[model samples]
Target chain A: QQQVKQSPQSLIVQKGGISIINCAYENTAFDYFPWYQQFPGKGPALLIAIRPDVSEKKEGRFTISFNKSAKQFSLHIMDSQPGDSATYFCAASSIKAAGNKLTFGGGTRVLVKP
Target chain B: DVKVTQSSRYLVKRTGEKVFLECVQDMDHENMFWYRQDPGLGLRLIYFSYDVKMKEKGDIPEGYSVSREKKERFSLILESASTNQTSMYLCASIPGPNTEAFFGQGTRLTVV
Candidate 1:
């Protein structure tokens, strides 16, 4: 069974708009949440990550909104641009011993139109 | 920069053929992982290792095996290739929990 679930297999956004992708997890042991971005033919790279201790994290135009009580997290891309078009994946893991085995969501393909 | 190199970017094999996908990391990370990527299905872990010669099975370990003889190298093996096994395979390494995992370019394996 998939421990982490993501919605909206794909999305389209106009330039300068905002794109949001949401994910949820069932494992209460999970405390680390991260988002990864991947371009065509390239490996997925780390975009941003958040710990349960924080409610939100922002890096430039990318922000991660996390709700620890709800066991949910979302990635919001502000001022979406064509260059921001890519596949986004949300993963959850624990930092305890034998942890860090990332349970990834289904993934969302975002297309930014100019 | 941390580099994880997969032996091949693309590979083709006949059904029933035994195949090996090799991966090497330069960072000497203690943890290594093998994941299978499929559209809509997302990335599924096949196997992982925390130390050399120590391995743990992931969600989809059936029909697949792994080897980690050295600190920097992790190998995925297909005991008998099948058409259902054709997919993109990715290798990743991380220093430890809560750390970034560096991934390889990935290997597209096609079994006919």
Candidate 2:
């Protein structure tokens, strides 16, 4: 029950369009959800995050839409650009997660076409 | 800037050899983690440390062991390097539970 399943292993989006990545979890204990963006030769960095009490949080072009009852959360990249092409990971963890452990999804390789 | 740094960017070792991957964080965070990244596997936690001399096995820790002698440094050791162990290893640190994790560039290990 510690798995976070992500879909659309790979995505291709036209520039100036919207890029969406979806993720689902099986655990209800998860209270915090964060999305990470990783470049080819770099480590992943925190992009945006949300708490279970909030339905959605937006930060510039990146937004996290969370659904508590459905056990799902998604990352929506508005005005997608080529520079946004990278592997995106969605993770879930409880406030008291062991070692602050995060359960990550397999990932989505996003390609923004110019 | 606060950061997590890995000792090596790339490493090559022969099968049956001992391998040690080192990581250090300057954030003085209480939580540190080691994960292996593969093509399809997003990031599999190998081990993590909450404090000095404290360690916990993660999801995949069968052939791997961890050492946390200090608060800022965490090391991952491979008992016997094997070809299957070749992958990108990443280190991360967090200030506390439910916080964002800072990661190192990653060490790509190749076992010959």
CA deviation > 4 Å runs, candidate 1 = A97-99
How would you encode candidate 1's per-residue C-alpha lDDT over A1-114 as one tens digit per residue? Answer: 999999789999999999999999999999889899999888899999999999999999999999989999999999999999999999988887373688899999999999
In candidate 1, position A52 carries an lDDT of 93
Q: How many backbone clashes does candidate 1 have?
A: 0
Q: What would the per-residue lDDT of candidate 2 be over residues A37-112, giving only the tens digit for each residue?
A: 9999999999999999899999999999998888999999999999999999999888776788988999999999
Candidate 2, position B38, lDDT: 88
Query: In order, what is each prediction's RMSD in angstroms?
Result: 0.8, 0.9
Measured with C-alpha atoms, the lDDT of residue A18 in candidate 1 is 96
Model 2 C-alpha RMSD vs. true structure (Å) is 0.9
